[model samples]
Target: MSQTRFRARTRIVFSLLALSVMAAPAAAQTIVSTYTPLDLENCRHTAGKAEEDSGVWRCAGFGGIPVHVTANDMRMYVSYGGNAKNEPAARETLASFHGEGTSIEWRSERAANGKLKPFATILRFRTSVADGDKTVPGQVLVVTRLAPGPVCRVGYVDGRANPDANALARKIADERARNFRCGTDKAVVEGATGPGFSPPAE
Candidate 1:
């Protein structure tokens, strides 16, 4: 082959290879199974009339700490209530439900990488247990994701426990938030393509 012709052929081959690479599908991310805390042993799941489109399971025998997971599979509960509007509206709706003394700590309606994301709220507060005037620190995380439909949200609340117990509860909540699968969802932001609830470090 002529040198110029050979160089042209090489360029064509490299171009094809580049195109093929670009056309290849990205590798799928491995999602681990749901995390079950050791504390929840022989706990009875709450049973009651469930909505045709949604379901909830509350597991509570874990040493006085209750863990609940709710799944919404349809468009019935997609909106954050009120006018069924956007993220700000949703945040307003959520804010209405805060306990009398609860304070809003942080929120991320927009994903980290600057994209319009589903509403997510993180709150911290102190709660007092019954019997006496003993109070303990607590954190509640609520995240809403738009996909597959109903915009599944995982609400986790933990309080009135020892340091180790608090750690375990936080871990369970973090894992639950992490491994949840909603639908063919894209990263609301550039970085977090999935649920971005990173439980606060103990």
Candidate 2:
């Protein structure tokens, strides 16, 4: 190749490298931060209407995905990571899930260790495609904890937080919401809605 052409190509390559380096920091900030960390803070005091408690801990949909809270003095909800559609699917799968748990499996793949907390259990679990899905991506690692009774759940959600972990977290949050049912204990957790929760301040 011509020396001049080679020089120009080298310049382009160096420019791209520089741009990539610059972009990495910003990308990391947003993607590597907490999952709805804001919710964790706000759930300290925020009231949602009669929340449609989805599942798990049952908080009446008071907490969004990956939300940490001592909401209504009920269980804190935290999602593994991911968008809304992620959780419902997992619930369905788990409901009829004759196979192994996708999230637990993925987490185990990258797990170097695990720890337990009060109402919170942190373990290395898969958050991505299952073992048989060859077309899917690699395994994911997720660590999470759930605190029962008017506690705040706070944690970092790496950009690549596991899909299963994300979905499962949502499932847990939904359950927690229902449990917080302000008026009745039929489907309630300690600090949640039943008689325990007081609608948080706006």
lDDT (0 to 1) per candidate = 0.32, 0.29
Misplaced by over 4 Å in model 1 are 1-113, 131-148, 151-153, 157-202
Per-prediction TM-score to the true structure, in the order listed: 0.26, 0.22
- Model 2 misplaced regions, further than 4 Å: 30-144, 147-202
**Tens-digit lDDT track for model 2 on 5-80?**
9999999999999999999986543211121113222233444444543223211121232422222222123333
Residue-level error in angstroms, candidate 1, position 180? 4.1
Best by lDDT: 1
> Candidate 2 at residue 122, lDDT?
29
Instruction: Give the per-residue Cα lDDT of candidate 1 at 178.
Output: 44
